[model samples]
Structures are given as structure tokens and as C-alpha cells.
Target chain A: MVPTNIKNFDTLVVGGGIAGLQAALDLGDQGYKVAIVEKDASIGGKMIRLSKVFPTLDCASCITTPKMSAASHHENITLFTYCDLTSLNHEGQGIKALITQKPRYVDPIKCIGCRQCEYICPVHVSDAEQGDFSARKAISIPFSTAIPQLPILDVEHCMLCGQCEKTCPTHAIDYFQKPEEFIIQAKTAVITTGFDLLPVKNNFQYGNGHIPNVIDSMQMERILAPHGPYNRVLRPSDGMEPDSIAYVQCAGSRDKSMGVPYCSRVCCMYAIKQAMLLSGSLPLADIIIYYMDIRAFGKGYEQFYQNAKAMGIEFVKAKVARIDKGENGSAIVRYENQDGSGIATADHDLVVLSMGMIPGWDPRSICPVSKDSDQFITSIKPKISPVLTNMAGLFVAGVAAGPKDIVDTITESGSAAMEAAKFMSNSHMEN
Target chain B: MKNPDNDKEKEAKKAAMKTLRAQRKDLIASASSRMKTQKKDIKAIKEFLKGKKATIPDIAEGIDMPKDETLWYIATMKKYGQIVEAEKEGAFFNYSLNEPEKTQEKEEV
Candidate 1:
């Protein structure tokens, strides 16, 4: 039997990523009770997975970890990780959300983050957090810096040898754990749902993910990350240290065929950032970025592009026609130079596709809020107030509203928190 | 007041159970032996990549295994720190045995 718990908060933030954490912290710091419902077991979101941010090249973890820690320990913030929000509906003056907590199989109350259970587990699974380039025990924490410091048992890969249960000194490993249901009532809601990358699977033009060295931008980030699977830049197909690398921009976005017609704002800068990191790591390697048009719209972004050029990272104004596997497992890129160079083909030891981003959550069935033409949550007053959603007392922030960078996302999250707090105060005024 | 036929049936079931348990033991032993033989193949891959940098196709050709199987082996070997990336040729990376100095230098960079 699953126990049903009831909780109340002044505001509810649906996501535990940077934007969500920011919004929660903003409200919580103001002494308003806030609850964060995170789909993942940890709260850092995509930011945590990243190696560094664009423009500044600052360490991504350095900026995100503190926010994660603060939100987790905030006096007025309650974090619900690994929760599936089933339904959110209006109830009287507040909104109520039904959430089902996925079973971790390890008792959170008793289990310590000692890692003994991880050591005793015999099953080894591909670590997706590290881009599947490394192995992790079946029972292990998502990462070393993951907040909450709890390990989850992957039942599918578990052998049921009772080894983890036996080795756990606290006897926190439960073989028969069940999901729990929880209800949260909040005066207002903030949707900070993030964005997902366009999948390379069955993308025929890009070799359908069959060409191993031709990776997506996110995979390139992992490859460039200090704690990446290999701890160095290498081609996935043959583990070769690449001497020549190419970045294909707009590979996933601005293409009507893929159904994502808008530009994914961060791809260009991230590609440049990764290229710069690659240059630092592989100084002898040659880097080329094939782009339709360079969008340096953000602050100091134009200079960042110029800096990359200054570092010998070649920028090619061309559209990649198709990527094919070349000899020695290299990627053959066919393209037409915008300068009327009819057609050309080049082979690069590695190819990175800057795929577009899509809304991470679809609210059609979950809530009454409408989505824009690009399928992101629609903001009624995007120009004047980007956080004001179509639904009353419901605000949208970050990539949930549209594709934006971390800087804009953080600013928008703060805006949403302010709006939600104002809405609560107005309600009190009416009462 | 037990029937003699019932007692005979019970004895027959116990004998069948004993045979099944022996079969289970044999299966476990066979699996263990198979695993031991598989280790030699992994060792062969490690030996082939010891000083040479080769792509997946190249390594598969050297080990005389299917490309998919060879890829899995490569991934596992890499996870266990048996191999390291040497260079990228085109679409494939050339992998060599993980040498301490080479990896350490790369890390410093």
C-alpha cells in the first residue's frame, strides 16, 4: 500500500533545473514557502551536465552547484526529486498538483551515502550521465556531486542477488518498495520545465547516429568535459584523438522538415565554446564550424565569436548537405559554400552536430495553458512581461516559454517568482 | 492410515527433485566455464590494441568478431581502463592500449 501525503506551499516550481532552482530560491529567500518538483533524482539539470558556459567559459558546475545546494538547504524550499506530476488543477484559491514519487528502492531515511552498496553490486551499466562512455554500478548515485547524496537501485539491471541489501550497513535497501503519492497545494505555479535536444536517431542526413564519431552538440560537451567518460577528447567510433574536427550548425533546428523551424538560441555559442575548449585541449588539431549564419545576439557574444576566430577556429559560412562515414571512420561532410563555391566535400576526423532544442514538457493534457507555434508554452505578454502565461496565477520561465540561454533563463525565473509572489499578495489583499 | 501407493508417489517426487537440482548445478558450472573462455577473447582484444591504434572496424577485423560485438567489447574495455583514444582518422577514432604517461599528459593539457 502506498501512503498519500499532503503538503502546502505558497508557490510550486515544476522542475529542478537551473531556472526552477533559481525561481524557487528567489521565492524562498523572500520567506515564501516554495516546493520544487524535479523529474530527475537530482536537481542540477542540464547545467550540471555541461562542462562550461559560453562567452565567459566559466565552469558550469561552479555556478550551478551552489544554487542546487542552497535550494536543497533553503528554509522555505522543499525539493521533491524523482516525482511524476500527474495532474495539476485549480482548487478554491490555490492550485493542487498530484505527484507520484518513483521508488528509489533504497530507503531515503536510513540509507547513508557510504557507497558500500555500490561497491558490492556486481552489475555494471552504461553511465548515461557521462554520455554512456563509462560504466556505473547498478546501485549508485547519479554522480559524485549529485545533491541529496542518495543512491537509486536500477531494478531492470539488478540481479536480485541481495548483495546490496546485505552489504548496506543501515539495512536501507528494500527489495519490495512501492511508489508513493503526494498532493501539493500552492497559491501559484511556476513552470520552468527545460528543453531537450533533437534526437539524432533515424536522422538520415546525419548518418542516423550510425557514424560513431559524428556526435551531437551535447555529446561533444561531454567529450570536452573534465569529468567526461574518457577524460579527454576522442572519437567515439575508434577512440582516436582527432586532429581535424567540424561543427555542423542548424543540423537540428531551422529546418521545416524536422518540424523545428525556429533557431535554438544557445547552439551557436555552445558550439563556439566547445570549439574553444577543444582548441585548448587539442592544440595541434584544426577546428572548423560550418554555419548558416552566426547568431551572436547575446552580451559579449560577438566578441566570443571573434575570440574563437582569433584562436584559429575556422568559421565556414555553408550548409552541410549530408554526413557520410568516410574511410578510417572519419565523417565526410558535403556542403555548398555561400560564396558560390558550387559544392565541396571534406573529411573531418570528428563531426559535431549542433541540434536544436525542443520544449521538455508538453502541457496540453497536464494544464490549460496554451503553447505557441513553436510548441513552447505561450506567454501572453512576451515583450513587456515574459513570465505572464495565459493562465491566471500560472507563470512560465526559462526554456519552458522559449529557447534562451542560461542568462536569460535566470532573469526570467526571477521575474516569474516576482509575479507569483505579487499574485499571492493580491489575493490576500482581496481577502 | 497412509496408503502404500501414496508413500511410493512421495518417494518418486523426491527423486525427480534431486535430478532437477543436479541439472541446475550442471548449468551453473557450464555458464562459469563459458565466462572463463570469454575472458580470453577480451584478453586478445587488449593484446591487439596494446601498442597499435585502430578503429572499430580495424579492431573487429583483428579480433575476427562482428563489428557490433567488437564495439561492445571496446566499450567495456574502455570502461575498465584497458584502452585509450589515440587519434581520429575520419569518422572513427583509433584506440590503443591505455598508457599511463599518454593519458596523464592529456589530462594535464
Candidate 2:
């Protein structure tokens, strides 16, 4: 017999990124109860952390936050933030998911979002949300616009200081909090777990992330953001406005040695967008993109590439062989020119590596969802309906299915929602 | 009358907290040492910037520290309101110590 305390929903969304948020909103509007389980403390995902989107150049946060707010405010949607899906499987006509809510050490019911505890905390640690370019208090809200507005206490960095405990007006600090486990049973499930960048530390050719001025693309996004660490695009080494910048394309993708042979499908467009933005910010600075090929395969993408070229951003058809630290915090890029020229090296004030995407979640241990040779979740009917997974009533969407651009991810999410809704309706008729 | 289960749970929580504190002893000690070093560095930078505005390169050369680490410290201090950007000097911006009392008074108004 099922426990009376088990929460029930019509559909379960495995991620709370833009894909999951859109799926939940679509199903909720269709009058179905939805549950969104997110791994992070907030639901905005990587989209919220980005500066802008490619091709359209729209503000990523502006597009993501409204959907986040809608999903949180929707009557039929329930959010399970800071959660881990322990196990998921088919159970009698429904899908059962065992979830564990990680401890925040602060009582959620009592937290008033006043931020007094964060302000009073003394310990300062490297802030990962800002790409480790700045420091945050031991206890802090992840960002200024974090949805719950609640603070997380980093027990690893905490000094057991009684300041935050005393400063919290609602007495929300509870150092003894434990992880709570729960169960959710739903008629359908959508796997929207997103993608993570291949770590630059693993790429030895890129100086193994030891070069101070050579940073990943996401760190560049933070540097370009309005509320960024330096508040402007400055070289991380000496806080100087860079006189020359270079973007190394296919740094991780299309390289079999790095184990990610497939193209990430978005790096080229994004590097172009960042270069265009950089030119606008620093008119006199020289911006160069070293690439094997420019794959402008999407609508308006070709034009976007042309516009960047019209703006005088240099596009060199070359393959960067290796990067090394130069004198006085500069990065030296050695590349082979594709025009039959010999290998050469150039020094730049800063270098940005366009890293490839890897699967964010592995369902091998927890669930039996099948994966393609590329390691992303496989769709049984990819040509006709790409959202249908091998598991009955199970669907996949966004980067979880494959590496794709934001537009395709959003469109695929809607298709997943429709497929899930159809599966639920068919099951209802059979019952 | 209090429930026996409640008492047992409270006792278990207390034991867990004791274990956690014992485990974190080394981490706390290391953090304290780091904090001391950071305080010395910040003090040195502030002394150099007393009644003067300087760029990151200038401050780093003055304190005999690496420019990158100096920039990290300067960025953190600026975020926490310990310093403020003064004006642009070529490609770099000069930073000066922020007056906390006056800033607080202005906020109050």
C-alpha cells in the first residue's frame, strides 16, 4: 500500500532550467499538477547566469526570470528546489521518484529573506556564482535575484560564529538540519537535465587552466555582465582594460583526444556574440576569433556572423595548437594557419576558450533510461517525435537529449510537454 | 509529559553537532590563519592608499605582491565598500579608500 504522505502529481520534471520551467508551465496551464525538482538552490539554471543569447542577442536573465516566476506562482506547479533524485522507475501505471532535499541549515519556513545574517557573517570565501572572481560572505543568497531570497550557510567555511545566529530576526539558522527524503508519484515524467561545460583543467593543451588570463567562456560571460565581478571587461591578471582579446574556437569540441568528438552546436554563435559585445565596449581593442570553421547553421546566424565581421572583428581560419603563459600576464596562442602557412604564435592580453558541453546527469545508476553513443539521453522516435523516450510515458527535452541552441531547447521543451500530456490522456482513457 | 522519542532525537542531534564541530576543527584553524594573512595584506594596501589613489599595478609594486592577487583583494574590498573607484588613468582605474561614516550618513538622508 502507498503511504498517505506521498505527494502526487500529474507530471514530474527532472530539471528546473528554462526547459523544465517551460514544460511545467505548459502542463500547469493544461490543468495538470506539475512538480519541478532542481539540483541547485535556485531554478534559473545556466540561462540566468549568462549575459545574453546568440543570434537574437536578448538578455538571458530577462527571458529566464519571468518563466521562473510564473512556474513558482502557478497554482498547479510545485517546486522542489535543492533536491536530488535518488531513484526513478515505472510503478504500476505511474512513475515513482525518490527525492532527497539537501540541507540548507536554515529553516525554510522561518526565513524572511531579510539578509541580516548574510551581512553580519564574517568569513569571506570565493564566490562561485561570480566565476570565483570575487568573495561572498560565509552565509549568502546565491545572487541578488535568487528566487527564494534565502541564504545558504556554508558549513565548510563557517567558523561556528554566533553572529548570524543572533542577527537572524526570525531565528531561522539551524546548524543541525538534516537531509529530508520524500516520494513523488506522477503519471508522466520529463527529463530536462541540462549540460555542463567540459572542464578546462582536463585540457592540457590549454595550459591546464594554469594560465591566469586564459578563462572559460562562462567566466567571460560573468566578466561581460553588467553586475559582473569587475563591472567591465578587464583582464583578470592586473585589472587592466585588455588591448587585445582572442577567442579560441573548437577548444574542446571536435577533438577526439578530449573524448568529446561531437560539435557543441552553440560555441561558434556565442563566441561571435561575445566578440561583437566586446567591440562595442572597447572600440580600439583588437578582437580575433581563431577557428577551424565557422558553422553558422541557424536562422539569422550567418547574418550575425557577417555583422560581426562588418564591425571589424577578425576571423582567422586557423587551429590553435596550444596556449602558454606569456610575460607579464599575457597568453600566447600558437596555431597552424589553414592557408598553408607555417605554425605561428601570437600574444594576447586575454584568451577565452569555447568549451564543449557534457551531459549534466547520468541516469545509469538511478534510472534505466537509455543513452546514445554520445552519452546524451536517447529518443526512441527521434525523427518523428524526438521527445519520446524508451520508457513508457517518459520524455526528454533540451540539452539532455542532445547539444542544441536555446531556441531549439525551448521548442523541444514544448514538444516534450505536449507528448507528456498526450501520454497521460491515453493512460486515462485506458483506465 | 514529554515524549521519550523527542528526547532521544534531541540527544542524537546534539551528538551529531559535536562530531561535526570536532571534524571541522582543522578547517576552522586553517581559515583563521588565512584570515590573519588576508588582514595583513589588506592593512598594507590601505596604508599605501592612505590619502592617495592608486591603480592595481601601483599598489602591487608598492606592497611587493603579485598583480593578480592584488587585483583580487582590491575587487573584494571594492565590493564590501572598503574602497571606491576614483577615476580612470589611461587603461586602469585608480582606487581610493571609502569613507564609511559619510556614506552611511548619506544613505540615512
Candidate 3:
């Protein structure tokens, strides 16, 4: 049986990624009570996992950590991590959200955030947070810098070793923990649900992710991250420092067969951004980007793309058709060079697929919100007010509305918060 | 925080732990077995590539293991500095043992 607890807030921000965090912070600063519901154990979201943001190439953590810390420490904001929203519907003048907080097994209050229990655990599992290039203990915190500093015991992989229980200073390890149901009431809501990269498994042209050296952009981000698994750029197939790397643009987006016809907007720039970073790390290695079009459509973005070329990064005008396993463990890229070279094939030590972005959440069954043809939450008045959703008192922001970069996502989040705040104040006046 | 009534809750937790331990014996054993096999695979792959450069498929066929599974082992070996990347042939890059820099020779592709 799940215990139900009721709470009230001025605004509810779904998805605790960058956009949600920014929205919550903006409302919280204005003295409005806000609730941030995150599906993961930590609150940093996808931005925290990123190595660096494009254009500036600044450390992503340096920018996101302070915001995460502020949100966690804010008086008006409460974080509900590792939770699932069962239903969200309009209740009278407010919104009622049914949330199920999945058990962490370890009591949040009693646990000291010490990693002693993790060290004693025997089971080892692939750490997806690190792009699965490394292993982590089954009973451990998501990362060293994970907000809330809580450890989650992976019940599926845990062997019920009493080692963690015995090692804990405070008997916080509770194996029988169950989910708790909670009801949150908010005058308005902001859907900042983020975007997810298209899966590489079913794409037959990309060798079905079987060619070991062929990785996705997210994996490339991990490889470039300072605190990443290996802490350096190395091919996953055999840990060899790659001498030549290729980026396949439009690999997952703008395809009729895969059902994603949109450009995904950010792939081209990110590919170039990563190529530049790779140049810094592997000075002698040849970095090439196979792109149909280089869309540097942001402030200082065109120059950033040109800067990469100046740094000797090659941008080949080609559409990658298929990837095959090469003789020695390299990835063979087959493509047609758009520069009048009918058909071409190239071998590179590693290939990174710039997969397109897809809407992170589908709210068909959960809420009354409608999605656009591209599957992102529909914003009825995108030109007049981009944050206004079709439903009243509900706003959508960031990539949840459409694919965008971090800069645009953060700006959109502020707009959403302001709109939500105004909606709540107007409702208060009417009452 | 310690009280006489708290003893009951502690006892319940102990019983739960004991039952869980009993149920998870096979899980623990299997985990150890998987680790052992992974270690053996890493060793075998390193030995096979001791003085030769080979692609993932070549190593997979040589070690009599599936291509997908062999990739994992080869990645682990590379992570630990047992292997280094060689030149690209056709579509794949050949991998060779990580030898001293002085003895290394650039392979002409």
C-alpha cells in the first residue's frame, strides 16, 4: 500500500532538467511556492551529464551546479526526485498532480550521503550515467556530484548482500521500502520536459550499433567530459586513441522511414562543437564532419563553426548512407559527396552518429495537453507567446515544445516562469 | 532513539535481511561467475593480439567468441592499456598490443 500525502504550491514544474530548474528558481525567487518533480534520483538532468555547451565551450557543470544547488537550497522550492507523475488534471482553480515517489531503499533522512555502503557492495553494474564505459556499485549515488547526495540501491542488480546494511553507520538501508503516493496542488504548471536522442538500435544503416567504434553523440559527449568514465577520448571498441574520427550528420533526423522528418535543429552545431573539442584533445588526429548542411543558426554560432574549420577540422559535404565494420576495427562510412563526387567511402577510427532529438515525454494519457505533429507539446500561440500551451494555466517550455540548444532553452524557461507567475496572480485576483 | 519497542522493528529488519540473503545466493554466485568469465576473456584477447593487429571480427573469429561479446572484452583491455589502435583497414581499425614507444613503427595503410 502506498501512503498518500497532500501538498500545495503556487507552480508545479515537471521534469527537473535545466528548463524546469530555471522555471522553479524564477518562481521561487518571486516568493511563490514551487514543486520540482524529477524522474531521476538527481536534479541536474541532461545538462549536468553534458561535457560542455556549444558556442562558448564553457564547462556545463560550472553553470548548472550553482543553479542545482540554489534550487535544492531554496526555501520556496521542494524537490521530489525519483518520482513518476501518474496524472495531472485541472481541479477547480488549481492543478492536481498525482505523483508516485519510488523508494530509494535507503532512508533519505537517516542516510549521511557517505559512500561507505557503496564501497562494501559486491555487485558491479554498467554505469549508464557515464555512458556505460565504466562500472559502478549497485548500491551507490548516481554520481559524485549528484544533488541531494542520496544513494539508490538498484534492486534488480543487488544480490541482497548485507554488506551495505552492515557497513552503514546509521541503519538507513531499508530493503522493504515501498512507493509513496502524493498529491500536489498548484495554481499553474510548467512542462519543461526535455528531449531525448533518437535510438541507434533499429537503424539498419548504422550497423544497428554493432560496429563497436560507432557511437552516438551523447556517448561522444561523455568521452569529451572531464570527469567521464575514462577521462579521455578513446574508442569504445578497443580503447585505442583514434587517429581519425567522423561525425555522421542527419543520421537519426530528417528521415521519412524512421518517422522523424524534422531537422532536430541542434545536431549540426553540436557535431561541429564536438569536432572542435576533439581537435584540442587529439591534436594530431584528423576530425571530419559529414553534413548535408551546416546550420550555425545562433548568435556567435556561425563564427564558431568557421573557427572549427580554422583549427583544421574538415567539414565534408556528404550524406552518410550506411556504416559498416572495417577490416581492423575501423568504421567504414559510405556516403555520396555532394560536391559532385558521385559516391564515396571513407574509413575512420571512430564514427559518432549525430542522432536527431525527439520529445522526451508524451502526455496523451497523463494530461489534457496536445502534441504537435512533431510530437512536442503544442504551443497554440508560438508567435505571440511561445510558452502558452493549448490548455489554460498550463505552459510548455524548452525542448518539450521543440528542439533547441541550452541557451534558447534557458531563455524559454524564464519566459514560461513569468507567464505562469502572471497566470497565478491573475487567478488570485479573481478569487 | 533507542527504546524497548524499537527492538521489534530491528528484529523485523534482521529477518528481512536474512530472507533476502537466502533468496539472493544464486544472484551473488552468478555475478562472481560473470566477472571471472570477463577477466578470462580479457586475458585471452590480450594473448591473441600479443604481437598481431586485428579487427573486431578477426579477433572474434580467432577467440571463437561472438562479435558483440568480443567487443566488450576488447574495450576493457584497451581501457587498461593492454591494447592500442592500429591503422584503419576497409571499415574497421586494427588493434595491436600496447608496446613501448621506442619499438613502435607506423603501419603504412
Question: Candidate 1's residue-wise lDDT over A1-431, tens digit each?
Answer: 32368899999999999999999999999999999999988999899999999899999999999999999999999999999988887889888888999999899999889988986665666678877765677789998789889899876666555679778999898756778898999999999999999888847899888886888888888888887776778676655678999999999799999889999988899999999999999999999999999999999999999999999999999999999989977889999999997889999999999998999998878888889999999999989999998778899999999999999999999999999999999999999
Model 1 DockQ, alpha carbons vs. true complex: 0.12
- Candidate closer to the true structure by TM-score (higher is better), 1 or 3: 3
Residue-by-residue lDDT tens digits, candidate 3, A1-431: 43458899999999999999999999999999999999999998899998888999999999999999999999999999999999999999889999999999999999999888986675667778877776677798998779989999987677675789889999899888988899999999999989988989868899887787899999999889987765678777655678999999998799978778999999988898899999999899999999999999999999999899999999999988899999767989999999997899999999999998999899988999889999999989988899998789999989999999999899999999999989988887988
**Model 3 ranges off by over 4 Å:** A1-3, B1-11, B18-109
lDDT of 2 by residue, A273-327 (tens): 9999899889999999999899999999999999999999999999999999999
Q: Which regions of candidate 2 deviate over 4 angstroms?
A: A1-5, B1-20, B101-109
iRMS of each prediction in angstroms? 6.0, 1.4, 5.0
Q: DockQ of every model listed?
A: 0.12, 0.54, 0.13
Q: What is the TM-score of chain A alone in each candidate?
A: 0.98, 0.98, 0.99
Which sequence of candidate numbers ranks them by lDDT, best first? Answer: 2, 3, 1
DockQ, computed on Cα atoms, for candidate 3: 0.13
The lDDT of each candidate is: 0.86, 0.91, 0.86
For model 3, what TM-score is found for chain B? 0.63
Candidate 2 or 1, higher TM-score: 2
Choose the strongest candidate by lDDT. 2
Candidate 2 clash total? 0
